[model samples]
Target: MDSPHGAAVKAEDFGLKGPRGWAFRGIGLDAAPGSLIAVEGPSGSGRTCLLLALTGRMKPTEGHAEIGRHRLPKKMAAVRRIAALGPVPGVNDLDQSLTVAEQLREGALLQRHYGAPIRSLFRSRAERRATAAARIDAALDAAGLDLATLPKGERTTVRDLERLEAVRLSVAIALLGSPQLLALDDLDIKLSDTERTEVWALLRSIAARGITVLAVCSEAPADAVVLRTGPKEDGAGAGRDADAKAEAEPAAKAEAEPAVEKDSGAKKDAETGPATATATENDADDTGNDGNDDNDDDDTKGADDALAEAGRA
Candidate 1:
């Protein structure tokens, strides 16, 4: 099987607002076909949402994008047909109980049944089986997975495989479709530095074959096109700092006011004491109200969870 020509990706102010809030906003990207594109960001920073949006698994609310010739939010179905997801949690996950060979066979069967042309199904059963085998072999080679090196070879279950090996298996399954665009989430999670480097090498090799690779990671490889996601220029940190200051201002004023009245008589104490104390209590209540502002960023996580659940459904 020959390698497919990769898909070109372009986006401008691409954003997705979910049930909670904006998952990602103001994203911009333009990459050529066969490019190794890495989506780098902190956890809960909408990295996964951006990956899904680019792959057509999630729709963008604010901006527009193009995957190959397919336009986003409108041509999502077409984009999905050309893009394959690799190891995205809660979406297209591998079964832990399945053996290595079983996983590969299942991927191959799914691709053959839905991805392949209807005319191809007219072939004899033996021929179809042979073709599926060839596809599996090609995908394994492209993904740099050698099953013979595993502890139990083809019989090895997913839970028993090492981290790098599991990643390789997922990539191989994605390759079974010969997708023009491959999107992988959490590419560097739970792996050593050496393994991260190796996995980047593997993705680069796949790109060398003219397949566009979109990967999500905490940090990106030097050679890949990097896109970072997070809060806007008017960031969340500044807002939190401002909120903290607002909460402290009344308390500071309340403390200073009582000091000036210390030299007053008992009558002054009776008159001003309750008022000062009441003001201080009100300030404390206000501070507690301000604390709720701290939870604004948590909405991003909620949005992500909602999207993940929608994907699974």
Candidate 2:
């Protein structure tokens, strides 16, 4: 498909195999600019690996991909420039100790040091600084991260911030360059439900601005194109089904036992009614447990809040 922003991302027959075994295979995707594509799978399903290949961070064993006008190369510097990654933020390999503003400044400086003209670097320091400030402001604004809210604001160190904040900071740094394609890994790792919704909204907004976003998530969002990665083992699906059954059995028993106890209680008012009451209590307890189990399952099946937030941002 053609991209809205004039940059298309395609991965054809992409497969990645390692010393252990095949991480992923038969992966093919095409994302238009302004679209959000989600790679959905369990942990260790090669989502991150696939992301690397598509973004030119790692080479696929059997196929290739294209970002914008540049094809994947043995060296991916060109593609990396146009595709900013949200994972690990700041730099591609981040320095964990740096403050938020320092990381942003360093990122802009590095981009200039590598990509800007030498004369421009020397002759227009003020202009360069202004450009960096504008880009940073735009990125932060887009991310819904107000530096002023932090105790140290821009001066707050990455290590000092919470995980969600760090994720946002990383996204802001990635946006500093105004990349054509944004690739994020595990956009929602750990966040509250409200936070997750906000994050997803932010990602959609970013896509609306004409950047293609490819994100790795455990569950697919409504607006994204979902890619499924199956379970790790052959009978994993069966095992999961069995586990669900095991969880439901106790609740079923509790409900059924209560009815039996009620039937038996019809003969006596106090003594038999005690048995019925005990059964009712057990049913309540089991129902509560079942409810908790269902909640746990939902959490597992849902997207990671931190990653989701980053995607939305």
Candidate 3:
């Protein structure tokens, strides 16, 4: 398969907010097509969210980003069609029970079913199978994965493969769709120094093929474009604090409301002591207040006015 030109990625003040707080914010980035963009940050620094947002899998709360001619999040579906995710935990993790061949076939089938043009679905089963097989082979070659080297060759389950091999398989699966932009998370997890170098080299080679590669890692390769998503201390913390304060204000008002009402009611009751007593006595003496109807009405009206004012407070 020939290389496809990748999308140019650009962002300004990009941000994503979650229920707890802003996952990431104040991000600025610019990278040309086919650039190997490294998202360098610690574990909880919102690197994953940034990756998903860039690929249009997750929407941003503020600012904007452009993937090729498609703008996020308005063109999220468009961006999603051109971009693919590789080995993202909780998003596209490889199934441990599936064999290498099974996983590759699954990817090809899913791509055909969802990503392919409507006319492609009309192709004969044999033609479709051949096409899938060819794409799988091309993907395996691009990913530098050799089935012969594995302990069980094509039958090797994901859990049985070594870390690097699993990574390669995941990349190959992602490549089956011929995505112009590929995003990978945790590139250096549980790998030795030599393995990390190999992973970076693999990504660089993919980028060299005119495919944009977005990789998340603790450190970035010197030659690649780097976008660092720092911890919450870098502006996002203030947003979280503001959110907390906003929530707290309503609860504080609710608590203070009852106290104010009680205090006002007590103050009004004390000031209208005689009126309050007379009103209570009139309530107990149901039919006897007709004798001095004018005075009784005056006391009752005064007490009612005082109660209404207290309730308003």
TM-score of model 2 vs. true structure: 0.68
Q: Please list all clashing residue pairs in model 3, or write none if there are none.
A: none
Give the alpha-carbon lDDT of every model: 0.67, 0.55, 0.66
Best model number under TM-score? 1
TM-score of each: 0.75, 0.68, 0.74
Report lDDT (Cα) of residue 65, candidate 2. 70
1-313 per-residue lDDT for model 2 (tens digits): 1123725777777665543355566777787767888989876676765666566444456566777766653324445445667753211434577777666655554444333434554645466556556666777887678999998988888788876677677677666656677777667777777777777887888888898888888887987977776654433232321222233234324422333323422212111000000112212222223222212111111211211211111
| Model number with the top lDDT | 1
Number of backbone collisions per candidate, in order?
0, 14, 0
RMSD of each: 23.0, 23.9, 25.7
Where does model 3 exceed 4 Å of error? 234-313
Best-to-worst order by lDDT is 1, 3, 2
**Candidate 1 residue pairs in backbone clash:** none
lDDT of 1 at 17: 64
